[model samples]
Target: MDEVAGAIADPVRREILVLLRDSRLSAGEIAGRFEISRPAVSRHLRVLRECGLVRDEVVGRQRFYLLDPAPLADLAGWLGALLRPSGWEHHLDALETEVHRTRRERRADRREENTA
Candidate 1:
């Protein structure tokens, strides 16, 4: 999971994943889409391949890469669990909101009292 997380932390790698999501592309084909050097893109592809985010196959002279989202399942579940709010969190948020509202009301009352 850590390796997958670190692999996708790079914007270039993430973009490569997006490109692969549609269809497999040869290394040269993928490199051509980027302004960076082919070697740089290859490095990013290597990272993705190592992390299991992508799988590559050799066909004749070209090596094609495609997305492999299986590793992302665990990461997605972990993120979902983290983002889910606990019951106490909801209560605490309501309490904090009420406290702020009370303070605002007291201030308004004080201003009115002073004017009167």
Candidate 2:
């Protein structure tokens, strides 16, 4: 998981993963999409490969890379859990609304008493 996190920490590597998400691309194809040098793209690809986020296959002398989302599942699940609202959230929101309503009612009562 650490390796996966580190691998995606780079913007270049993240872009590479996005490029490979829907379709496999040869090293040259992937490199061509970026303004950086082919070697630089290759280095990013190496990090992704090491992290199991991508898999490369040799076909007709061209190495093609594709996304392997299995490793990301754990990270995604963790993030989802963090983003999900806790059970207390609804209760807290309700309590806040009730407090505001009670304050408004008390202010109204005070106004009525003062008017009387």
Candidate 3:
């Protein structure tokens, strides 16, 4: 997962991932979209493959890279936890404190009325 995160940290690599998301593309096609040299693009692809974020297949002498979302799914699940309510445990604790405060105030009010 560390490798996956590191591989996607680059904007160029992220774009490459997006490019391969819906369709498989040869190394050349991927390089054509960027102004960088083919070797640089190839390096990015190699990192992505090593991270298990993408898979390459040799199709008719052409290496086609395809996105494999399994590794990303782990990251997504981790990020999803951050956005979820369970992530906001402190907020829930605050709400619970407020509820208890309100209940104590109500109880005190009733006791004063009964005493009067």
Worst 10 residues of 1 by lDDT: 82-91
Question: How good is model 1 by TM-score?
Answer: 0.74
Positional deviation of 21 in candidate 2, in angstroms?
A: 1.0
Clashing pairs in 2: none
lDDT of 2 by residue, 15-96 (tens): 9999998999999999999999998998899899988999999998889999999999889898899997788997898899
Sort the predicted structures by TM-score, highest score first: 2, 1, 3
Q: How close is every model to the real structure, measured as TM-score?
A: 0.74, 0.75, 0.73
lDDT of 1: 0.95
2 against 3, candidate with superior TM-score: 2
| Number of the predicted model whose TM-score against the real structure is largest | 2
Model 3 spans > 4 angstroms off: 86-116
Per-residue CA lDDT of candidate 1, range 7-92, in tens?
99999999999999999999998999999999999999999999999999999888999999999999999999999779899799
Backbone clash pairs for candidate 1 read none
lDDT of each: 0.95, 0.92, 0.93
- RMSDs, each prediction? 7.0, 6.4, 6.8
Candidate 2 residues lying further than 4 Å off, grouped into runs, are 90-116
- Per-residue alpha-carbon lDDT of candidate 3 for residues 1-116, written as tens digits (9 for 90 to 100): 77888988999999999999899999999999999999999999999999899999998889999999899888888888788776468799889999999999999999999999
- Runs of candidate 1 exceeding 4 Å displacement: 89-116
